[model samples]
Target: MHTKDDWITTPVTADLLRGALDVERTEHGVLPHRLPARARAQCSDGQLAMAEAQPSGVRLVFRTRATVVELDALPTKRVYVGAPPRPDGVYDLLVDGRPAGRGSVPGGNTLTIDMTTGSFETRPGPPGTLRFDGLPVGTKDVEIWLPHNETTELVALRTDAPVEPAPDPGRRVWLHHGSSISHGSDAESPTTTWPALAASLGGVELINLGLGGSALLDPFTARALRDTPADLISLKIGINLVNADLMRMRAFTPAVHGFLDTIREGHPATPLLVVSPILCPIHEDTPGPSAPDFSGLGEGRLRFRAMGDPAERASGKLTLNAIREELARIVAQRAADDPNIHYADGRDLYGAADFAELPLPDQLHPDAAAHRRIGERFAELAFGAGGVFADSAPPA
Candidate 1:
C-alpha cells in the first residue's frame, strides 16, 4: 500500500534507458542522443544534430508498485513563424506491455525555424511535468516513451513506490536507420510512429537512428550502427540522397557499398535489410535538391518541389527509379557471399496505389494513418514467416 507522501525520486541513468546510442549528462538533466559523442564530433551539421536528439524510439523502462508516477522533462518545441502551431509532442505510457496512459509536457524551449531563409532562433523555456495516476496498484512494468519529434531533456522521475530498472524483455534489438519518414515526420505520437508500431508488433527492442534530413550515407552513421548491438538491422535509403541532391549514381554506388562494408566489419553475419525509399511521386522520376513550395504558407500549409533539372538524369543525377535499380543490383551482387543481406523494395511498402488512397498531406511526409499502414505492412513483410528477419529470433 502506498500513500500520497511516499514519493521516491529515481536518478535517470543509462541502465533504465533504451533505444538511445548515448546519454549526455547536462547541467540541468540527462539528454538522450541517438548518435554517440564520437560520431557527433565528426560532423558539425546543425540539422543532423537536432534530428538525432529527438529520440524517435527512445523510452525509459522500470518496474514499480506506484499508482502515480510523474516525469519532469524539458522538451524543445519547433515553431515555424508563419505555419500553424504544431501540436505538443505526446508522451506515451505503457504498463505490462499495454497502453496505459498518454499526456504531453508543456512550456519548454522554442526553436523558431524560418525555412525560407534557412535560419532559426532559440528561446529558453521552463521544464514541465507529465503525470500518470491510478495504475493497477501492484508491481508491474512501466515504459514511458518520449516524444518522437520534440527534443527532450529528462530531469527527474518520481513515483509513490520505489522503482527498479526493468530487466531486459528478452527481445532482439532492431537497429534501424532512415530519413524523416522513419523519424516519424508527421506521426501523431511517439508510440504511433511506424518504427515504434512495427517494433511493438514484431516484439523487438528498437534503436531508431532515423535522422530526418541527415540519412545521407555518412560513414559516421554506419560506424554508429557497427558499434551498436543489434540482432536485426535495416537501412532505408534513397529519398534523402535524391532530395538533398547529395550525390549522383557514380558516388552513390560506392557510398552504399562503403556503408555496408563498415557495418559488416562489426556484424558480418547479422541480418541486414536494405529498404529503398517509399514512393514520393514528385521525386520518383525527377531528380532533386528539393525546394520548399511556400506558396501555401499564407494558408498555413507547407509543400516541397523537386528543383533538379530533368536533363541532369542523362548525366547520372539520381532519381527514385535510378536508386531502386542500383540498390537492387548492389544487393544481388552481395547476396552471393552475404546470405544475411537482403533488399526490400520501397514500392512494396508504399506504392503509387497507396498514394492514391492515402496521399501524403504535404506531398512529402506520411500522415498518422499512413504510418499505421506502413507499420502493419512492414511487420508482415519483414517479421512474418519466410521474411528476411523471420528466423533471427523469436519475438520477446
Candidate 2:
C-alpha cells in the first residue's frame, strides 16, 4: 500500500466519472453536466440550464491503494434573496461501497437569486479542498459523490497512491427524473437524497435527472432519458408543473404522453414506473403558480404558498389531484399492450399521515427527515418484494 509520503495528483478525466450524461472541459477545470450538449442546446431557459448543470447524482469513481485522498473543487452555491444562507456543499466519500467520510470545501462562488424580482447576481469566491484520510489497507474502490445542489468544477484530485478507473459493480442502473423534491431539496447531502438512498437500498446504480424548477415535461429532457442506458427508470411528475403554471390540462395531457412515448421508443421493454406528486396539501385542491412568502425572511426563514385560486380548477387548470388521476389513467390504458409500464402514486411514499408528523419545511420541498422517510418508503414499495421495480432486469 502506498504511504502518505507518496502522494500524487491525478487529472480528472471522463473515465473516472459516472452518473453525468456529459462532461465539458472548462477553462478552470472539467464541468460535469446532467444533460448532454445536444439537449442543452435545444433549450435556452435559464432554469433548465442551471438545473441540469447541478451534478445531483454525479460521482467520481476510482480504485487505489491510497490511505488518503483529497479533491479540490470550485462549487457555485446558490443564495436566495430574503432567505437564509445555505450551508457549504458536501462531498460524501465511500470506500468499497460504504460510507466512509464526508467533507466540504470552504470557499467557492455565490449566486444570489431574487425570486420576486426574477433577478440574480454572481460573485466570485475561492476554490476549496475536501480531504478524506485513514483509509484501510490494500486496493479499494472509492467514490466521491458531488453535492446534489451545487454546480462544481473538478479542479484536481490527489491521493497517496496511483488511481485507476473503478471496475463496474455489475448492478443495474436506475435513471430517475423529477423536481426539486427529487433534486436533493432539503436532503442533508448528495448521497442522502431520496433517489440516492433508494438506489442504495435497491442495489442499483442511480442516474438522477431531478432538475429543480425544470421538470416541465420538456422534450429535450425526454430525449436525454431515451438515449441514456438504463435497466430501470422512473419519473416523479406534477409539483414543478403546478408551481410553474406553465401549462393547462390541454397541454399537460399530451405532454405527458409524448414524454412517455419518447422514452418507450428507446426502452421498449424496460420497467418504467410513473410516479405522481407526493402529498402537497397547499396544492392538493388549489391551482398554482406557487409564490414565495418572505414574511419570515428578516428572521432568515423562507416559505412558499400556492398563488392560484382553487376555483381555477374548474377551468381545466392542473392541480395535484388532477395530475394523479391523469397519470394513473395513462399508465392503466397503456399497460394493456405495454405491460412493462407501471404507476406508483407518489402519495404512497409520503401521504397525509406522514405529513402530519414531518411536514415540508418550505411547504414545497421535503425536509431532511422527510427525505429519509420517502427514500425508505420508495425502496420498499418500488424495489421491494412484488413491487413494480422488484425485477430490474429487462423484460424477457
TM-score of each: 0.98, 0.97
lDDT for 152 in candidate 2 is: 97
What lDDT does model 1 reach?
0.93
Model 2 lDDT at residue 306 = 96
Which 10 residues in a row give candidate 2 its minimum summed lDDT?
Answer: 387-396
Q: Residue-wise lDDT of candidate 1 within 1-396, one digit each (tens)?
A: 666566899999998899999999997799999999999999999999999999899999999988899999999999997888888999999999999999999999999999889899999999999999989978999999999999999999999989999988898889999999999999888899999999988888899999999999999999999999999999999999998999989999999999999999999999999999999999988999988898888787888999987788899999998999999999999999998899999888888999999999888889999999998899888988878878654432
**Which pairs clash (backbone N, Cα, C closer than 3 Å) in model 1?**
none
Q: After superposition, how far is residue 141 of candidate 2 from its true place, in Å?
A: 0.7
lDDT of 2: 0.92
Clashing pairs in 2: none
RMSD of 2: 1.6
